[model samples]
Target: METLTNLESFVRSAESGSFSAAARRLALTPAAVSRNVAMLERNLGVRLFQRSTRKLTLTEAGESFLAAVGGNLESLQNAIAAVSADDGQPAGVLKISVAPSFGIGYLLPLLPEFLQRYPRVRPEWHFENRTVDLIAEGYDAAIGGGFELASGVVARTLAPLHVIAFASPAYLARHTLPADPSGLIDLDCIVMRSLSSGRIRTWNMRNAQGDEVIATMRETVVVNDPTAVREAARLGLGVAMLAVPDVLPELESGELVRVLPRWWADAGALSLYYPSRQLMPGKTRSFIDFVVEAFQREDYARRFAGSLG
Candidate 1:
């Protein structure tokens, strides 16, 4: 007899069309997924996927099995989620993703308190300069930038992350501040690579008519790490752009100077985003509340200083 859960693995592989992608979806290792599928095939006395060096395709049995079992597997998952949602107090692990600078500059301090508040809640926080495909990666929730997202995902705004341009005082003294916003183009700049979209990050500038234009700079340096980009700016290497709250300390200390006072870009928020499943795991709900409540508390906001957003 074959386990239904093993069959579920086979189904996931078929849906994603790649074992590695399915592994990410299931939060399992690719080898484990392959083993489950192999075990299922042996038990059923039929081959499932036709494998080759570059690709794998479902065999006749796999296609029929999916047609029979896919809906049932989805229902089973929904039932589990329904049961998990009723817990009075959330327990177990919550896997969350967030931007690197936001984690270090803001969230890290609150973590001590959050963990203490709910001893049973274990959080696995992934702090990177990249965005994870939440459903594919099996993340419970993520704090992300920008506004638009897939319709099936839910987003709750935590706070605003105002963006601004700043350069080290020394760099400004040498280059002479751009005559206007457009003049920054002529000078050297450090480009921040967008992890989620893979598009070259550009400053979105708006004219008086409210039309936005992307300002592309000649990149003198390309860096993925947020801290490294700020460091580059700090050392007078070039003008670097970052969230406003991130460089406030440097601004106050006269280490970095805000380039233009009037123009600013909004990062919208560091939001709590999750899938639109009918029943969210209790841990997922708990974390969203915790983050939202934490941001609302006056003391908590003060603690982060300017990085509250």
Candidate 2:
């Protein structure tokens, strides 16, 4: 008979996406997790993962195994939790999804502190701009900023960020700043295609007085990463809309200058979202608390209204 420990470790490795992360969650050595997985593979007589330096992707066998056993293990863990709520500290793998740009700019830097504080809580962070399927993909929680969400999930606000339009000082020095967004059509625009929307975004800028300008960007330098877009804008490529947190350093240093002082775009708020559950797991609750406390710090999310190109 297969041991529950073996099944537990296998499921954790699959959810965490690597042996090292799984081991961290289990408070075991990476080699130990590797051994557990290896033993299971040997017993089953098939390969489970196709691993590489770049990524750890699941094989068909691994996917099938995860699908078959993940929910059962989750149920078992939950039942144990309900019976022994106060018996122990929270422990388990926390799989979180975040956008690549925001993770790079803000969240990733704070992770070390979180790990140091919660020794029993191991986090497997996935930085991808793609939409997260909480149930299907086995993610415990997701940190995202968008106006919309899929059906049946619960979203909680993390922070509200304003949309600012900006461009580099170098670009403005060579090319006159567009006094109004209507002039943006004549200037270079850095186009970012949304992973979720599957369409190019051209936002309308509106002033506090209710005046509006629809900035239709026809000729744009394109990039997928928001960091790349910010870099391009910093290097004088074009004007771009960005979250205030991402461009704060530039704004403070005067490296990037805002356009159209009075008008601001309606950028959506940032949030942490997950699939609704009748019983939130201890791991999930701890993860949410850590994130909420981090971003709720007043200085962490403060941003001004202006042009960010």
Candidate 3:
């Protein structure tokens, strides 16, 4: 019988398309992964991969082998983990990626409760604005708005990421508030430069009357992050377009007030994404359920919908 470690190395290398990538996911050296796969091929007496400098392509035998074992590898690992643990408790590191603003303003508050309930689970989270490769990078999950769906991953919507214009009371007191999207052309607007596109984003806004307009504001301050834009607006720098979830506390505390209240930009849905598998890790499953329950309990979808009063 082939050793489980060798089988794991072979399967991961095949799935990731390169031994180096598989090594990263498995926390092993590239040489070690390659050796294990080489040993496996020697034992089986069949060449599984067509090796090339650019990419690793699976041979017919390798494809057949993967089809036979790939579907069951996760189940086998979960079974081993359950039998090895003391009580099958959800105990492990849960790595996640989230946007800085949402992570600080919303998810941070719920961490204490999650930790209290699952004492054995530790969270390793990254606050980033860009989308990450969940499987390649070995992330358990991620939270963000409008990420493209990757293979073997699924997303669950938590809330609508709606953005509206906001300005500090002091700034509005001195400058005239915009009555509509067109009026924004005369105001000093704080805008965010898209990191992926390398361009200043244009605002696509809609009113209650179903009229939509694409407005380009006079940029006074250009930033790369939403948090910086919110801070600039709060400092009375200029008007900013921000998500309701990011500015909810400031809006409630009277630090910032809504401008052009009738109009908001429909960005997309904020979602929690994870690898779609038949047998998920205990820690990952627990975190997913806990977060979903938390969102439902808070009624976050409607509360942060960015609708005007």
Candidate 4:
């Protein structure tokens, strides 16, 4: 019989393509993972991987074995995790990925209360702007909008992602406030360049009555980040279009005011993403419930809606 650790090491090594990566995911040393795989090979009487200085490649035997066991590993792990949590307390490392601005501004505030409730769960948070593969990257959950739903992943929407035009009061003081998108042609416009695509982003804005208009503007400043766009607008550079959640604080504080307030573009829904598994880790389940409850209690869905503007 093969040990679960040996099977897990072989599977993770096969999936990640390197012992070091597998070690990181498994929270083991590279030597330990290598030894586990070696042990598994010794037990099975066949080499699973072709070793190399640059990359780890699976052998024909390894490929077949992976195909046989890959699908069942997750279920076995989840079952073990559920059983290990005998006290029904959510305890362990809760790994999460989130966008920097949104995570720092909103989610960070909830940490104190969350930690108080789940004292045994340690949070490992990665704040980055790109969409992460939740299962591949070993994240328990992720928070953001516009992520593609990959296999074995699911999304729970928290709020509407509405892009609306905004500028500092100082900037609007010097220029005419656009009555609509067309009036933005003569104004200096701060635009967002897509970080993934390397192209300037433009949206088609709509009103409550379903009136649509293209938000075509002169791109005076092109920034690749939401924070930069907000800051540029705050520095009175030009008008910027941003998601309501991104600039909610600025809007509430009068640091930035909405321009063409009646119009906004529906980008998508801000979502909580996680793996779609039959049995979830207790910590992941608890964190998801906490965030969803917080969002509901605070009425963020309505507050983050630009249509209400």
Candidate 5:
């Protein structure tokens, strides 16, 4: 029987495609992971990885071995952990990925309460805009919109990711308010560039009658981050289309006012995604329950509906 540590290192290294990346996820050094793999290979009398200066590729034996062991590794670990845990308490590092603006504006405030409730579970969160490979990166969960679902992953809708147009009072004072989406072409619109596509994102707006129109605007300032676009609008730079949740504080506090109240961009839902394991980790299950309950208690879905009342 192989040592559990050696098996874990092999599985992670194969999934991540590099010892360094596996090291980061496993909380070990690259050299340590490499040595573990080497020892495992020597014991088995077969080379597991085709090593090169730039990359590591799995050999035929490695691929077959991974096919047999990779799927069961997490379950085995979780089972052992469950047995060892005190009274089934959720105890482990719960790693998650989230967008920066949403994580800071919404999720960060809820962490204190979550921590207080589950003291044994430590949260490791990454605030980024890019979609992450959950299984390969060993993330427990991710929260965002429009992520392409990987195999063995499932999602639960948290709230609708609605976007609406807003501008500072001073900006509207300087420029004429557009009567409809078509009139937006004449104003200086602060737009965000798509991180994945590397193109200036076009505005998708819908009327009360559910008629959709793609609006093109004259760009005054182009930013990559959603928070930056909100700040630009707040500084009276130009009108901007931003997520309702992101600018909720500013909108409520009178720092920004609605431009076209009837029109909004229905992108998708903000969702919590995780691997579809038969036996989920206690920490992950608890977090899902906590977040769902919190959303219900706060009525976040209705509050973030992107409607001007």
Candidate 6:
């Protein structure tokens, strides 16, 4: 009989269409997933996947094998995982991805209490600006706005993603504050280059009464990251459009002030993305619940809203 590990590797590789992706889902290396698949193929005496540089395709026999075992395999694995979880504490390497500014500013502070409560769980965090493939990259969870919800994933919203124009008091002293979104074009504006699209990011600003305008500002400085943009604004380089969470500290400190207080952009919601609930491990579930509860208790949803500007 084929070992459950080998069968799982084969199935996940087939589903994800790559050993690397399967490795992430299985918490193993790509080589380990490949080796397991190879062993399974050797045992079955048939090739399961057509290997390639860019993509993996299932062979005829591989497709047949997958159809035969996929459903049963998942049911068995779920049963095994459920039993194991019931018997043990939530303990494992919990891998997550988030934006550096938000992770450090907000989520990092929550780490100590979380660790104290769940000492057996280890956190491996990746702080980056771009959206990651949760299944392909093997993240336990990701927190951010504007992620394309791929197959087998679900998102729980934590807060509104509200983009508002801001600038230092020094910069405001040199230039008149914009009366509306239209006047923003006259000011020196620091803009962000979208990491995924490699283009200047723009947003449509709206007021509570439903007045809408596209914020087309003259880019005096361009940056790819949110933190850098905030710093540039702090240095009196130019007015910058940033999320409320990104500028809350500066705003509170009287370093940064809102430009168009009534006008802001609705970018989307900052969300926590993960694989489906049924397939989630104990650690990931615990982390998700903890984060969601924390966000609620802190009322981050209201605090992060640009409409409050």
Q: Local distance difference test, per candidate?
A: 0.74, 0.75, 0.87, 0.91, 0.89, 0.90
Model 5 segments more than 4 A misplaced: 15-17, 24-28, 39-50, 55-75, 81-86
**Candidate 6 per-residue C-alpha lDDT over 41-104 given as tens digits, one digit per residue, 9 for 90 to 100:** 9999999999999999999999999999998897886776576467657777899999999999
lDDT of 1 by residue, 177-206 (tens): 764457778878887886666676776754
Candidate 4's C-alpha runs over 4 A off are 1-3, 20-32, 39-46, 59-72, 84-86
By TM-score, the better pick of 2 and 3 is: 3
| lDDT accuracy of residue 66 in candidate 1 | 85
Model 6: what TM-score?
Answer: 0.89
Give one clash count per candidate, in the order shown.
Answer: 0, 8, 0, 0, 0, 0
Task: Give the distance in Å from residue 215's predicted Cα in candidate 3 to where it truly belongs.
Answer: 2.9
- Model 4 agreement with the true structure over 258-294: per-residue lDDT tens digits: 9998999999999999998777888888999999999
Q: For model 6, state the Cα shift of residue 240 in Å.
A: 0.3
Of the candidates shown, which would achieve the greatest lDDT relative to the real structure?
4
Better of 2 and 4 by lDDT: 4
Give the better candidate number (1 or 4) by lDDT: 4
Best-to-worst ranking by TM-score: 4, 5, 6, 3, 1, 2
Clashes of 3: 0
Tens digit per residue, CA lDDT, model 2, 161-186: 66667888878787876777888788
TM-score to true structure, per model: 0.76, 0.71, 0.84, 0.91, 0.89, 0.89
Instruction: List runs of model 3 lying over 4 Å from the truth.
Output: 1-6, 27-71, 78-88
Models, CA RMSD each: 4.4, 6.7, 3.4, 2.4, 2.6, 2.5
Consecutive 10-residue window with the lowest summed lDDT within model 1? 300-309
Best-to-worst ranking by lDDT: 4, 6, 5, 3, 2, 1
Lowest summed lDDT over 10 consecutive residues: which window, candidate 5? 80-89
CA error at residue 139 for candidate 3, angstroms: 2.3
| lDDT pick, better of 1 and 5 | 5
The global Cα lDDT (0 to 1) of model 5 is 0.89
